[model samples]
Target: MHITSGSALYHYTRSGTSVKKLYEASWVRYCAVNRSGDKIFVTNSMSELLTLSKDGTILSIFTDRQLQSPTAVHVTETGHVLVCWKNTIIQVDIEGNKNVTSLAIPNVDNPLSMCNLGKCIIVGSSNILVLKIE
Candidate 1:
């Protein structure tokens, strides 16, 4: 689902010939579609994260005090939401209430992209850095 800044929600159907209207919003960005295609995760960019159903209903919104400029989001196999911004990555639980962890890449100059490769996650900016998880 794609939410336009002008307050329109657009979604493409499986048939690829049909389009559906989800809802309206003043601002929306950074959308992550779930594997099941029944739900979508959206980040307001300037604000918090929003979970919306396929039919246009808001399932939940996380308003944690520590969230700042959430620019990138990815969901893990364990159903955890990983948010990346600047030099930090925050992990949020399924309910969006519990914060699992917040990781900061030490001495990162300018991180522009990131990729997860199984046990290691690579972040790229002016230079590429890989972080290994145990």
Candidate 2:
């Protein structure tokens, strides 16, 4: 599926058609469509963490006020969602609760994108940042 963000998620159809309103938010900065296309990982650049179905039904939302400028997000194999802010990264559980892990990240300059590669999380900023979490 081709994702073009403009306030919502759009899925490209096979016949050159596309589905609109897949997901709606004020600041949907980045989205990761799961390999199955059943679940979605969405980050609002100015708001909350959103987990939703392909049809736009929100499965959950994490309301932590710390979610400011959430530039990117990735879902881990262990089922945790990692959200990246300007200089920090936060983990969210399945229940939409923010995990209390140490928010300390060293020498980050404007984090911009991220991806989960099973065992570790690779983040992209002004430069590339890789964190190995066991």
- Clashes per candidate (backbone, < 3 Å): 0, 0
lDDT of 2 by residue, 1-134 (tens): 64747577777887868767677667666776655666777777456777788787888777676677677776676666677777888877644456655365677755777776766678887677778888
Q: How many pairs in model 1 have backbone atoms within 3 A of each other, for residues 3 or more apart or on separate chains, i.e. clashes?
A: 0
Clashing pairs in model 2?
Answer: none
What's the TM-score of each model vs. the native? Answer: 0.73, 0.80
| lDDT per residue as tens, model 1, 38-108 | 66667674567777787768888876666776666666554667766778777777655567898987766
Best by lDDT: 2
Specify the poorest-scoring 10-residue window by lDDT in model 2.
94-103
